[model samples]
Target: MELKPYRDNVGALLFNGAGLVLVARRADMPDAEGAAGGWQLPQGGVDPGEDLRAAVLRELAEEIGTDRAEIIAEHPEWLTYDFPPELAGRGFRIAQRYRGQRQRWFALRFTGRDADIRLDADSHPEFDAWRWAGIEELPALAVSFKRPIYEVLAQAFGPLARALASAAKSR
Candidate 1:
């Protein structure tokens, strides 16, 4: 039996031309690093009545300050994770009211330069820093609770990331 509804969320695994994925450190954890909490993908809640695709793009712009990306792939089904026991009763409304998040994951190919990523684009920014990480490095960089989701994403998108990276190398 579930305790509460899962929050509707969308996550973007943004790949740069070199096939490196974009990971950003949330503002709240500006100095955190390693598996306990370090970096995470660009993702956010889906607003009421908004399309998932649009939500992903909006989240990218909101979280990392760029929408210069093209959707290349999507996970076949929604994936979910639960909030850690310690955080479940915290003040965060999502954790308080939801089991975790039911996410639609998108793979996006970045078409802009590194300079285009400006975390300050939003006055109230979610992330304080950003970097392009190897796809395999995602799970290790994420918070522990989100590591399973990140691992699944790395597997689902690994081939595509490698292909894109190789293509970039050939040119």
Candidate 2:
């Protein structure tokens, strides 16, 4: 099935105390136009009448296989970015649906153990594989369009991650 680029969407970022962030690899899902190995935080579009926070939780469950995770913080405002023409689907350009996505950033804490991750729980798995990576490493791993957002995320979460690192050292 192909999405007609409705231009309306939402997503979230789940982080953990170890200073490691969860990232997923895109499934080689047909009609999806992006690099397969490219990594990103778990996220999906919001359903009609659904609250954004609920959408974030739903996506987390579907993508990361958990019904709940601790939300440490969230951006007070929404963050948005545009997709380059070449990176966009044909339908996206035809619909001209608001150009790109407007997402509410979330900072989540995973409460479950590593064994809890069920990568194949969904009808369409968003990721083929995943790993915990440094926040600073994300910009380098992300696609060009998402690199700027990674930079923003690094700045937004850098201090907390550092504090966690410092705490671990004192243990």
Q: Mind giving the per-residue lDDT tens digits that candidate 2 earns over 53-143? A: 7788888898878856877778776676666665446444422544567677777777788777888888877788888888788788776
What lDDT score belongs to each candidate, Candidate 1 first? Answer: 0.88, 0.72
Candidate 1 residue-wise lDDT, 76-113, digit = tens: 99999988665654455668778889999999999899
The runs of at least 3 residues in candidate 2 whose Cα sits more than 4 Å from the true structure, single-residue gaps closed, are 1-8, 29-35, 87-98
What TM-score number comes out for model 2? 0.81
Candidate 1, after superposition: displacement of residue 117 in Å? 0.8
The CA lDDT at 22 in model 1 is 94
Top lDDT: which candidate number?
A: 1
